[model samples]
Target: MPSSINPGATLVLTGVTHILVGLTHPRLGPPLLSMVRSGLFDSITGISLDPTSSGAPQYDRMAAWWFELAGAAMILLGISIRENINVAGYVPRGVAWGTLGVGVIGALVQPLSGCWTLIAQGIWMVGWFGKTKME
Candidate 1:
């Protein structure tokens, strides 16, 4: 089997999951109105309490979005590692394991429905480990 095939497919799938869920979750979530009023597009680049000062729920929504983006980036890093891309100090195998922890920790803060994502993350982490020959 080609080295790139496993991680390539995994990262692409994971990347799509993160990107789509992150982008759509805000509009489909509790803070839709607040996010739209506060310029949701800009918020993705950076977030401050000013936009979500209405309440804590709004802040949680933003935090979830940030995590989605970060997850996507981590997937890319994992794929890059498999490809042997020179990424300074990052190791893809480490990134893969680290994201599992992130997903587990996220469940503590996420709503019940959000636990599905965590479960999927856990499954993917285990699947990635078993499927990839990444060192």
Candidate 2:
């Protein structure tokens, strides 16, 4: 048990960040793949289109889809956790920890884009009052 933990803010910020990342992937990830996928939206994102042309873009798209859903799920789960805990109930600590783990893994995987999540989730995890906070 930690001395101080503002589960509310933690859940809200982390949840929103995850949701935004997931939502943006679908909205923005496709254009970068236009040359590889063959479609309307066309542009360059600075990342070499070479890999996408190498047949790995298919898998890349699939992974992005997974991350999108994961983000949505995080939002829902975070809300549920906040609600359950605030009202006073048996919201298992494991649930929070597990969510944090998943979030951190995703953040670590894409530190460049997920930097916000990385820092936010890290704070949420430490379970500190002013700075870090985790379970």
Candidate 3:
């Protein structure tokens, strides 16, 4: 079946995908990793505690990884909404809520990194809100 979609929604989805791809890919990855390593970002954001000698967070890394994955998922979710509203139905409202939840958790844990994810999820949430179902 032809996708029941809107042009503006498609633009939003494509824009979000481009942003997520840029953030996650290798070109931007090292700079981001360097920021995390150097503590400059944390210093500016004021969210980090002292790390042990191993140079890792005292807490679990899973939440940070989850936030990144959620950002990627939001890109996919936007694509699905653009290409197929039926696929949108498969995603469930909970995914958006879950994304927002992760964003909040990530922000609390690592403000700088988390804020980017939060913005992505927030954009996706806006796209979702703007979408309309066509019979």
Candidate 4:
């Protein structure tokens, strides 16, 4: 009758996976460093293609920046979930709903992404199995 899923652990694992995936990009360093150095305001210009250059240099930079940023964010989310669970003995319903909302949006925007896992995690945390308080 009990669910095998541990939402907190799952979130943490997801975060770790995200970070690892981001690290796999060969040229993520310069772009990420540039964003950091400029307080990310410089990134507002977005990706601009150089007519003189070939290939997807600009696109790759932007992609790496976003991938790394998302990975860091996911890690933070996992930490928040774990801490909340530790202190409250359960993930708040609001957090579950929020995750579900984000998951839905992400899934809609990028159907091939791992947002479905977030959706599943949200549903599990929402106490469909009658585990959480749902308050």
- The models' CA-based lDDT, in order, is 0.54, 0.52, 0.51, 0.71
Each candidate structure's TM-score, on Cα atoms with residue i matched to residue i, is: 0.45, 0.47, 0.37, 0.65
What is the per-residue lDDT of model 2 for residues 1-135, given as tens digits with 9 covering 90 to 100? 333234544555665776566556665466335534655243223345466553223455555555656666656765665565445433455665665576577667876665455346545544522232234
Clashing pairs in 3: none
Candidate closest to the true structure, highest lDDT: 4
Better of 2 and 3 by lDDT: 2
RMSD score of candidate 4 (Å): 6.6
Ranking by TM-score: 4, 2, 1, 3
From the highest lDDT down, the ranking of the candidates is: 4, 1, 2, 3
For all predictions, the C-alpha RMSD in Å is 6.6, 9.1, 9.3, 6.6
lDDT of 2: 0.52
* Candidate 4, superposed: residue stretches over 4 Å from native: 1-5, 25-57, 128-135
Off by over 4 Å in 3: 1-74, 81-91, 114-132
The 10-residue segment with the lowest total lDDT in model 1: 84-93
What TM-score quantifies how close candidate 4 is to the native fold? 0.65
Give the winner by TM-score: 1 or 3.
1
> Which candidate should be chosen as best, given TM-score against the real structure?
4
Look at candidate 2 and tell me the lDDT of residue 19. Answer: 57
